[model samples]
Target: MKKLTTGLASASLAALALGAITPGVAAASPAPSPSPTADAGRSAGPAAPIVSRIEKHGADRIALLGVAPWAEQVRMQFDGGGSVEPVTDGRYTFLIDKTHLGKTATLTSFAGGIEGESIDVALTLDEDAAPGIIPVMPRVLGVSKDSQGVFVIEGTVTYDPLQFDQLEVTASTGGMPIRSVPDVNGTFTLTIPAEFAGRQIGVQAHLGNKSSAVDTIDLLETRPNTASDTHPLAILSPWAGAELAEPAVTFSGVAIPNSQIVVTNDAETDQRFATLCETNVLANGKWTCDSPRLPDGEYSATVTEKPTWSSVTEQTEGSSFSIVHGDWKPAAPALPHLSSITDSGDHLIVRVVIPGASRASLEVGEHRDEQQGINGRFSFWVEKSLAGQTATVAGLVDQSVGKALDIPLTPIADTITPAPLTAPVIHHVADEGGHVYLEGTTGYAPFEFFTPGVIAKKDGKLIGSTELTYNGAFILRLDEEYVGDEIELFSTRNLELSTATELVVAETEKNSAPETFPLEVTSPADGATVPATSPTFTGEGIPGAKVRVEDTTAADKAPVLVCGADVLADGTWSCEAEKPLAHGEHTTTVTEAPFWVSAGTPTTTRGFTIGDADSDDEAPIVVTTPADGSTFLAGSDVTFTGTATPGADIALHLGYGLAPVIGTADAEGDWSVSRWLGNAPYTATVIQSKNGKQLSGAHTGPTITPAS
Candidate 1:
């Protein structure tokens, strides 16, 4: 599959308020301290209501934008019986049935009643008189060095994806554009020749009429130790040029089974090329590392081992292979952003937006037809003689493959019956006492009734299955001994079945839970406002239990499964989001999965706002215990204290924009922060804000000289 992993950063916005002012520093105003309020720890209040909208994209799908910071506690039901699924970044999408063209969707807030905030939104849409094109662009995530010292590029193509069917990666050094590698799901990975290393390369995607903005990445220089002579490692199977059908395969060979092996792409130039695989060699002297999901491409896998008997590492020549999926590698875009398939009895209807394709075909089993692509849209129907057949829509711009959709067909009894083909939404899965309980909502469609089911499996063996109620709500309880098993929640629409969502019942027999399930967040101080987008989340949980930190800001908010570390023996854990959260009040919840303990785990929640979007005019006051111009040794803990608006976040910046320490003020409007200092002449200041606005002036902090 094509791997579009590239990304681009937006320019930063300027802050408004100045906290404390100090002489001899330019623009040295810091933010004031933060204070907790009555609404502290609350996820949603009357401050902001959820936003909802319904609009048609191209001609096939409807874009449902109901995601808001306040959407987590909201329950939704549509007037026409159609269902929606949450996508990335708090957004959702659903197929637009012609029967439900003029329908409405109602959202009722406070579904969880956790914050007592109530509101409602009714979204209605009319057929578009003037359809607009949805823009798509390619993003280059990064470039890595492979075992053979080549660079591999990865990134994604995003947007409603009206067009841009071709992908290319070229270096500033100028060579023919590397065009069209096999891609899957809009992401592509290409191996760069060794000569392109250490140069700035422009990665772009192309459509018949337009191209995406060029994303650039500087390839790292190749290291001299490309081949290590001392390491003992060899790939045992799948020799060079071997062909594999699966996206992922296991690479095993002889090595110090108990030692560490770094396996990587032989010619990719990214830091991740060298992946450490720890091992237990089988009795036959085979060690293994499962390769990551790879797109269609030629790749060489290399392995290096650190033997237990020697400190020196041994490297072996890599094994090369090819992964071939389908024949068509079209530069045409995938179906527009919200393309979908509907099962209609003996036939399945497919609709998608494929820009610039004059000819398109809907292929199901042995049936194929020349379909038209109009206004970046393609809609057609194919005979569904066999249920569960894979549906493919191949669109061609000038007879070349440009866009394609591979949708799975669900079985339906007849055209008159409606089915909830959308997948069920899993709400929560936890261990209550010694039983595992799974709860969620089933798929729904107008005039269609859904029967949800829960399936339990271990090691690919079906352990159990049960049907659920007609209310679209399901509760499945399992024995505690099945803690490590995998559970799937599914719903059946008409004769068509929705895709299942799998959740693992964590194994926690060794690291027993504490009596009260200790999980508490220390930073952002429960409703404290800070300027940073990705603030650090620090807390304590059961020492051995796996803690899942979820951005519970909205019901549609996809949880961040593992943002940080495993719980330390001391029970403390710290993690931060790889990307920044939305710029508003966000509710974050930490829950311990069913690990070591048999009892249900209590969840801990906190709320905080990301400030610094809008500027505040008020100046803040910052006061540190150590007076300005004082001297101290390196590695000494220093305490910084200040005052600000009762709830403003105080950011203590040492030097200029370096070593920032944040603290929230107490009810008394006083705040204290502490951190260790390395050897340097430190000038202190603070930046204060709430909801991205400065609440006070920047406060100038004391300066201390750190002695070596």
Candidate 2:
């Protein structure tokens, strides 16, 4: 009987163990049995005091707390949206959206277990003086290909519900701007217009009068593949509209299990003959196949699922694909050499000598066009705006780079409208037999002057005369044998009599060549500061002679050729640097090497500096609006606010490869930036800049967690 009693007690204790406390929650003590007098009224029980509390979190968020048992079936109604959940510690937590400050909130608790009265609580939210909406700028994450053949732009918008009514994203492809509204998450994904293909596009986000910085992307050189809706098998790798970096690529997709998968570029032909990959589908219905190294071209693939047992054969339509050699390296070739540069008053004439080139083109400032040349020789006419600028001439054969040349322009006088000449002057005179070849300068502009005439006489007696072209150039044939006398050459333009230029022939030497001088720089006056990266380097050199320019700034550094050129017939040469030079002092040496033997070295040392036009290099200061380390919903928007130097611009970079959003600070140095991030642990950074230069370091904010 004693053992039976003990067994009964053991079983009773086992039954009591079922009411144990849950993890992370405090165990509640059982209420003592009511006294006999207190339970006198059998149908009635004493009332328990209502327990409730309220906590303010931020300008827009509030927390409501209460006892767990009583909080069950409790409802709190306020503004915007709110949620309630029970915590393990016998407490109920309610996240209330306090959109209207100073407004009363009602919390009603239902009767507990049908024995208690329903309780109602009222409370007013604390007043907030801060501005309702932050002025943070919007930003873009980046650009990518959507399922469609077009591009999709993604970004975020952080704004105040009380201030702005809407946020819009816009895209421009040289036509009417396309606009879109961000979803509830403050994130937007917009599809570009079909007409945007082969065009440079610009995207931006707008909120009323405020606009985000324009983000530009180039799609002019690429062709994205559009997916076919009929294909049952979806190609996973080398996704449609994907720009690949390699030619040899692998394709992956999903199809029916145990069925044969055949990938081919040709839809009309049997895939088995020109199959890129042919294999039995895996148990999981996934398959992957690699193709041979493909040349840079467009490709398509289709799959055929062969039947087994009672299964029927199925074939998928062709899918779009392309092979672009974005990383292909080409063989290096010799560069085209600049031969000469001449200043022709209003325009600069540059000549280049390219070798082994079948075609060539000249690029002068914003103008680029193909030009014809005989024997690899090309000449380009540069406008006045190109003064002190670099001109490039590219030689091509089979659409491949054969050679390239760069020349500089430095005119002696300002660009002026040609004025009629007061008089024509005779300059060069050469006598062959009784004929005299002459070249001269004229004040008359092109296409304005008539043909010129020249008369020759010895001792005031008419000997011979000839008429010449209107270009102020002539050759007088004096057939008379007026030996041992001073012969005068008189030039007349349109019957306007001009003074005679005397020419005496005394013992003319046969087979005599004109003298030539070495290379020398004349314009830009030595030690003058020029405001250009490719400043024109001008000087005198032997006519039609080649010269090489080498920058010898530092002895320890290797010599860099800034430019190369040929001397013009007028003994002047100009060449622009092949590339811009860095800031600091530079000493360039120009050497004349017409025949690559016994060349002349006449070097010039000049000091110049290049300044950045965009930035001041000052670091910007950034602050997070929600004060970092905050938590939010998975698709909720997160706003960040910070301070920087007044008039500085701020940008917020969200994690997960998203494009950055940009905002400008007001005069008070206050700024706010916002973005809706994905559900994950994210640490963001704020960048500040004045103009285009960075003013501050990457001011990073605390990490934030977004829950589902």
Candidate 3:
């Protein structure tokens, strides 16, 4: 293809926040540390996911602008809905679809291979609910100059996308921006003035703050058919001129596969090529034909190809050949091998070694080649443009006998020096209208070296990009509309982006948390048994969290399938086993999935038998304080106590719909939680588990009744 594999560095805004590859460093260079530090055993783990954008209804496109730092995986669980895990490249943004208004999404990140904190995000319907547009990058397919001298460029964007509304064209040689409207299929065509011929031009699609990678094309007055894979028409055998031994002349050559060749005798006598000589085109494009006996001395023929496809038909002049009946033909020379191809920036040095030939010639594209004596070696200098094309080396051992070999060419980049490193900083400010600013110190010096670029993003949206360290300092300005906006500031030296620092804005400033839907440990009574197959677990969690079942009987406490359940409207939930369980005593735990930050992270565990319960494994739960059927006086500090399986977590529930007071059972199966009950007499229920973070179970000590 005529198009080269190149990247649009400045314009690929969507591609900047991706992957872990460090920029500017070669395989032998020192490894640079990540901006927020490496992804090793970090105790702080991944940062909580921020709500980047939330579209109300249309697509319900939910997004978080920046990826969670150090997150290997991220999961989202909507209260009463299933979870969507790892939906992004952990870069620019994380995305999911749903009309999640008034509902919360629990975002949990795992970093350094450890489960981190889960943050709840709920977006309100407002102008800020929608975020910046999705980025569309256009790729140039082909470029050519029309007969009218105008350059025609064609390209495509990823989706028949609305995101690609405008095509922006810029020329490096100076010119105003050229714009074009792209069709619905994400395809666009535009023309550049003839003056741009021989100059490099860059084209990309734009949508607000986002743009695709630029496709730079070097314009040629008349585009050669360089995109075609069909090799240019040529004669590869009996090469050009070969004296024949017998008068029954025969000719062979190569051309576009399956073509019809016509050879005309150029002699003044009748122009027939001795018999209607029409050769069959081989799959490999080789063809041969035999001519009737001829009393020939020296002669030339015009060879023409009539293509079966749309390719142009052209005539080629065959080098003159003579017919010598006494067998004066020489043996064909062997193929040639390349000794070295060196790059001198503007041109290349090609050295070849051919055996069994005293003289040879080399041709690279349209370069003029000269015949040179070959003591098994010959050298040629060719244009730098031929770096990715092919070169041919031919040897002539005798009259009418020769062979040619093709070798590919490649370019080399030898002198590469990187720019010095610069550290960047971002300052956090509360929401208020004013001239906001950030300034920092840098140790970077400018000695004519290419400096690292700095891009500032607010809520995962590009805000500004600036050239840093001209003389070791840089400045950027922002209006008040971005006050209280979260932005990440970092320096990008090579290909990799290290998240430098962030200006955090608390969502609570604009959004209030949804009412804390009650969480209850209310099902699968502790020590209850059921069939080994289709085991069922049930519970109730604060709105916006799913329930999960875990096999707590095991040493490591493995998950029971992906066993999960959406919460029922009435503050209850039920989940079924994904697979069959073993017919033995087991301790199962159920807990709200994607642990939340606030209160109500309720969990419960139950020991039950699939076939027969092991009496020793079953631990009965007991509530010893605020005695059963008893009530504490209103406005009194009450201490409740319970006992269950050793090391089990405890949740003491007061009937006033408040968050559970949590405690843990010790080795002796003892647990207690003290709470100040205010203004109302209340009953209490105790729910115990094999572990605290387990699932919901039926409340024990069902009543401790007393009137206010």
Candidate topping TM-score: 1
Candidate 2 all-Cα RMSD: 39.1
Q: lDDT tens digits, residues 1-708, model 2? A: 000000000001011111111110100111112212111112221122123345587767676555423224444555554343432323455666665445544443333322222233444442332222222334444455655666665554433211212456777766688787754324455678555666776767666565767767665324222111111355556667655534656676654434467777774385356777776543223456666666776777665665321212365746667766543322221256554454533445554544324346777667775654432344455555678877677776443464465656653221111222233233344453333443333222211101223555566544444322212222233322454457775543311334666766443432111123444564333444433355545565543345566777788975666765544322344555656777655677666643211232344465444434343434358574665777766544577787887877676765322335668888888998775444346677876655334554678876777643
**Per-model lDDT:** 0.46, 0.45, 0.47
TM for candidate 3 is 0.22
The TM-score of predicted model 2 comes to 0.22
Q: Could you give candidate 1's per-residue lDDT for residues 1-708 as a string of tens digits?
A: 111011100000000000001110101111111112111122322111223335666776565444323224434466647442432332344445545555555443331343222223334463432222222344454456667877666544422111112233333448677764323224455567888767777776554345656767677633222212211356754567877654665676654323456677767777665453444432112355666667888877766666432322454557788887533222232232124444433444454434334456666777766654322334455555645777676656443464356656663221112222444444455664444555433322111111123344444333333222222334344556677766654443211234656777763342223443356665657767766566756666543344556676777745543243333322444555545776777887776543322335668887878766455434357584778877775645778776776666676766411225678777667889986554446778777766535564577758777643
Better of 2 and 3 by TM-score: 2
- Candidate 3: list runs displaced more than 4 Å: 1-33, 36-44, 57-66, 91-100, 111-113, 129-202, 205-708
- Estimate the Cα RMSD of every predicted model relative to the unseen true structure: 29.7, 39.1, 32.7
The TM-scores, one per candidate, come to 0.26, 0.22, 0.22
Candidate 2 residue spans exceeding 4 A from truth = 1-275, 280-292, 295-619, 628-635, 677-681, 704-708
Top-scoring candidate (lDDT): 3
